[model samples]
Target: MTVYLEDEQQFFEKHLGLLEKVEAVINQCLDQEEVPYEVEVSLTIVDKAEIQEINLEHRQIDRPTDVLSFPQIDPECIGKINWDNLDTSSCVNYDTEEIILGDIILCDEIAALQAEEYGHSLEREVCFLVAHSMLHLLGYDHMTEDDEKNMRQKQENVLQCLAILR
Candidate 1:
């Protein structure tokens, strides 16, 4: 899997260790779910102002969310997608065997605030956000209680594998 990260905010320190940790967590989640290793994902870290602008432009919320996931797979095209159960065979390319997962945008400032409110480290909060965003990229939606439970469980499992637990 390939993770392309872009940091537009200066609030958090961008380090190789943090990037590697996030990558490791993503890899572990894919491995556990038996997803293909040829997927490509993009992660963008922005500040509250930037994220709020994006939110207003895209979602019309006019507020900054901790994370926003832009899933490439549309429901009609992907067909009955679920995060907990992934089908790698359906995602394989004819030759390269690669899958374009999707893109995720995270507000670093909001994440930091949430981390403080949740009484956890920034690293843990960021990791959790990444994991949650990844699940959304893979076609997870928490529109219902059951769906929320499933997605939350998957996020926790990925974090636990990375030794970043609640």
Candidate 2:
């Protein structure tokens, strides 16, 4: 997995070792999901205002959230599509010879507050968010109670697997 990470406010510099943590989360999630193709994920860390605007624009929600994932792969196409036989690859990034997994937008300000609220380091909070978003990009969601529980367990497992604990 290749992550194109952009820190809008240089928060990674403040948090220390944040980039490595995020990269770990992304890699671990992709591995856990067993994604068939070489993949690229775009991650951007933004502030509260930026996230709020994005939330409104994309989700029609006016409030800021911790993270948002825009997955390029359709869940419907997962099992049905033949990886080797697909002639026209809409999701393929030809130059990189990787699938475009899509984007994850994180709220730097929200992560800091959540870290403080949850009594964990900012790195831990951000890493958790990265794991959650990575799961989303891999076609996981929490739309139902069972689904939420499953996602929670998956996120916790990823965090624990990485030894990124509270």
Candidate 3:
């Protein structure tokens, strides 16, 4: 797994250690899932204002959220993907020879606030957010009750696997 991480917020400049842990958590999730092909994900840490703008533009929601995921492939059809016979005409990254998994956008301000409110460290909250977003990139969603339960369980499992406990 190749993570292209960008810290667009000044708040994260002093938190490089936390950022490295977050990256490790994401990589661990991919490894645990036994993903076959080489994958690429983009992670961006942005301020509240920037995330709100993105939420408005992409989701038509005028409020800031903790995190957002933009998946390149549909989750429902993931099982049917023929990795060996992949047609790289559309989704392949020529330079890296990896499948473009998706993008994850995180709001630094919101994450910190949630960490304090939830009585956990900022590092834990950010790792959880990254784990959640990674599942989304893998085609997980919590739109229904059962789906929510499953996604939640999966997220927790990933965090647990990394020992990033609450």
**TM-scores of all predicted structures:** 0.83, 0.92, 0.90
True-structure lDDT of candidate 2: 0.85
Identify the leading candidate in terms of lDDT.
2
Query: Model 3, 1-166: lDDT tens per residue?
Result: 7888887775557786776788788787777666688889999989999999999999999999999999887643432344555665677799999989899999989999999999998888999999888888877777888878887787788788778888
Please state the error at residue 14 of candidate 1 in Å.
4.3
Error (Å) of candidate 1 at residue 32 is 2.7
TM-score of 2: 0.92
Score each candidate by Cα lDDT.
Answer: 0.77, 0.85, 0.82
Residue 97 displacement in candidate 2 (angstroms)? 0.7
lDDT of 1 by residue, 77-149 (tens): 2224553455656654556666767888998888889989999988899899988888777667898888899
Q: Candidate 3, clashing residue pairs?
A: none
Residue-pair clashes per candidate? 0, 0, 0
**Of models 1 and 2, which has the larger TM-score?**
2
Report residue 64 deviation for candidate 2 (angstroms): 0.9
The C-alpha local distance difference test score for the whole of candidate 1 amounts to: 0.77
